[model samples]
Target: MQMLMYQECIDACFDCMVACNSCYDACLKEDDVKMMADCIRTDRECADICALAIKAMQSNSPFAKQICALCAEICEACGEECQKHSHHDHCRRCAEACFRCAEVCRRMAA
Candidate 1:
């Protein structure tokens, strides 16, 4: 069978979700957890959106493009938040994944 359309975006979504979860957990473990509250919230939001976007893309939902667009926006927001504390290895890694995911999602939405 031919490869599905938007496969790259779907894969990126999954990868970003995993990275977001890892970053969220790491943020919780930090000594200054309060500083990471926004990051933690956004990470979870980004992860959830990425998961839903993958489902929409997989089934070729009419809203797949819309989902991808939203996912890209959320990824950007989460990535920016992660970038604020690049000293944390987990945050840095998550920021990279989110940026990559955002790029693919925008392409798929186009």
Candidate 2:
């Protein structure tokens, strides 16, 4: 059960990473790129953190729970930031992905 849960969390993290990367790239292409600078930076950070959390969980590190808790927080913040640009489909999709990943991370942390 524990292994399966960890695998699912890892998968969620990877999915969130992909979504964040795509959203960041799309944001850069927008005409108002400067307005989205913060979003882009946060997306990149969230993706990196998610990846790190997944690696820690996969390795059964003692810090996995703490990492997952932090990941959840980052995911939620990223989601909220992305939601600010809901007019952009990429941002909307990214927000949804972040929310899903946050839920998974929360469960893993619990």
**For model 2, what is the error of residue 45's alpha carbon versus the real structure, in angstroms, after optimal superposition?**
1.0
Best by TM-score: 1
Estimate every model's Cα lDDT from 0 to 1: 0.94, 0.94
Flag clash pairs in model 1.
none
Task: Find the 10 residues in a row with the least total lDDT in model 2.
Answer: 1-10
Instruction: Tell me how far the alpha carbon of residue 39 in candidate 2 is from the true structure, in angstroms, after superposition.
Output: 0.9
Alpha carbon deviation, residue 89, candidate 2 (Å): 0.9
- Residue-level lDDT of model 2, residues 1-110, one tens digit each, is 56676998899999999999999999999999999998898899899999999889878889999999999999999999999998999999999999999999999999
Number of colliding residue pairs in model 1: 0
Q: Write the per-residue lDDT of candidate 1 for residues 3-103, one digit (tens) a residue.
A: 26777788999999999999999999999999999999999999999999988987778999999999999999999999999999999999999999999
lDDT of 1: 0.94
| Candidate 1 segments whose C-alpha is farther than 4 A from its true place | 1-3
